[model samples]
Target: MAETITIEPITRIEGHGKITIILDDDGQVSDARFHVTQFRGFEKLCEGRPYYEMPAITERICGICPVSHALASGKACDAILGVHPPEAASLLRRLLNCGEFIQSHALSFFYLSSPDLFLGMDADPAKRNITGIIEAYPEMARDGIRLRKIGQQIIEMISGKRIHASWVVPGGVNAPLDAGHRQTMLQMIPEALEIIIRTLALFKKTLDQHREEIRTFANFPTYFMGMVDEEGNLEHVSGRLRIIDAKGHIVADAIDPADYREYIAEAVEPWSYLKFPYYKPLGFPAGIYRVGPAARLNVCNGCGTALADQEWAEFREIERGPLMSSFFNHYARLIEILFCIETMQGLLAEPAILAARVRAVAQPNFPEGVGCVEAPRGTLIHHYRVDEDGLMTWANLIVATGHNTMAMSRGVLQVAKRFITGAKITEGALNRVEALIRAFDPCLSCSTHALGQAPFTIRFMKTDGTILGET
Candidate 1:
């Protein structure tokens, strides 16, 4: 009979999940599954709310990435009003989003994922935490905190709060940037740039140590997707959809955001609330693709900024074509930080960014709207239908992490097959399985819209229903 081993609540992650390793009668690993065990139904919850309130209401999705939700929601509301925000307001929104990417990526790298990268997967669980990083690599730890704070400071300067400011609105931002605020933010950028440059250099050298991981951690070929400027430059706030294959060929380019339904589709499985999004042309599982940092870099021809462009060139040189390993998300993330800082600085230097007229007032002019933005994790889409009175009738949110669900599942299986052998599983081997999922830096809380505390239970049992162990 086949036996089952379950790892409940994969540790050092944002939300609850379990990894099930199924062994055949002969005791070798046969298959593995990653289960998302919670659901909040944010989409269903938003029905009947006023369209203008979406920026505030949907911002409650997750504290870690509420700004992403707010911006996307605000953009959708803008569509309903049939108005484009003034140039100043648009620039301010982009600056806010850049801060979000910097902070969120920093958290993933320093607090959650760094422990494994620095302390080793097999290190004592007690010694594998931020405190551990602090004690062992004090300077690196301090730099992480300082860098994250810089990102947060920019958000606070512009929006008056760190997490959910509710400053974004249907047509534009609530306020304009003043000269003092702009200069203050610019002063902080130079130091942030230094940190990103230093960190990327160190991380690239660190990659040489994990030889086996570089090759097998979610490394298979697949399609990549994200937003890009008209010139095929990396863009976040506004751009057309672009999809590239693993072989470095552009499969689709300059795809209009409204036409996304023609290219992307979602699938639901009994084991998870998060839907699996795939390339519509290739169909379900076969059309599997990746998003976020690695996917963004793969789809764009350049980073658009000078420093980041140089880094992008070097990143592509690692494998000759589109980088396939999810492991490289860490590197791509740092390069983005550099790009964000540079881009934000340039926007602040423009005197027009502090213009007094930041908003454009208008009533709802459209019955439906779709908003898309490149969030820190991946591309986020917010689609809403409204009544004539401007009240929301329906909403569908395709979050960044949700888009990578299928890729994460495939990754779990590949990693399990590579590591798990025989019946006896070591803690080290199990942790490595968890580490592969972390490489995607999935925010399951945002992915599933889950609420409340779910129980974390692991069980070891046989196919005959006999319980052998439980945690």
Candidate 2:
């Protein structure tokens, strides 16, 4: 008999999901799938709204990466208006994004993932949480909290609210960075940098303990994708898209964000709501690519910032080719936090960042536009088409999490084959399976938003499609 093991509602992720590990008739792990069970209809809901309302509306996608959506949407609207924001507006936007990167990466590293990395994977489920980590490592926990708070403070200082702040507009930001607030944020930088540096040093010392995971955990060859400057420096707010293969050779470079639809396409799977995106030239599954911290680091020549550039060099030294191990996403994420702080400090020191002319006046001049950005998770693209009256006719959003959906599914299978036994699945093995998903740091809520028929139940069927069971 072919049996299947199902783990429902994978915990510690942004939204609800389930994993099904399929077994062969011989009781050996055959394959696995990651399913996003929820349906979010953001694209369909925004159809009749004005294009100008997109920034505020799309920001509701995920509480964690709302700023990513807001900025991308704003950029798309900027295209529609045929106007460019003032330099100060662009600087402020980058500063806000840096804050987002710091807070979000810190949350993933400390609150969600530290328990598994610091404590044993087999630790009691109830005890493997932020509270547990706090109890075990009080000072470290406090540092993480303080670091996250500093990022949130930066966001609030510029945008006026921590979440869903409509500060970014079509052509630019609604306000400039206040002098007093800028000084306050500048003061917070050194402490934040110290926290990340200390945490990174401590994490580096533990690499020896996770040698097995480092070697086997989703450590496969896949093309990497992210934005990069013209000089191939790491960029978060704006840049051209770059895709590189497993051997560190650039497959595509200087690709325009406006032409994304020509290069990228989404593949729908019957088992999950999330769509799989692939490079169009390579066709469907073969075009699979990984994004986020690891991918960004792999695709970029340098981080452009001084301290981060030094860390980037060290990160690349771990592998002659691109770093393929998902386990290193943790390290990549911390280094990004360091980069975020350094970049934020540099932006604040610029006098032009305080200029009062933040926004440009414009009316909708284009019928269609596309906007792209490096969300904390990965590459995020927003596309929109408007009617003559400037009302949106259609919208498409490719979130960072969706870009990595194909890779995450494969990661589950790889981990299952390594850790799970069909005869008996232990808690430790199950934890490792879930850990693989966490390694990708996917945002299910952001990935699953589309209009479609949603299947609420998952069927456990044989390879030949005979139904074994459903949940």
* Global lDDT scores for all candidate models: 0.83, 0.86
lDDT of 1 by residue, 95-194 (tens): 9998988898898888887888888877888888899999988988988888889888889899889988999988999888767888899889889988
Q: How accurate is candidate 2 locally (lDDT)?
A: 0.86
TM-scores of the candidates are: 0.93, 0.94
Q: What tens-digit string does per-residue lDDT give for candidate 2 at 302-366?
A: 99888889889999999998998899999999999999999999999999999999999888999
Best by lDDT: 2
**Model 1 lDDT at residue 446:** 79
TM accuracy, model 1: 0.93
Runs of candidate 1 exceeding 4 Å displacement: 268-274, 450-471
Q: Native-vs-model 1 lDDT?
A: 0.83
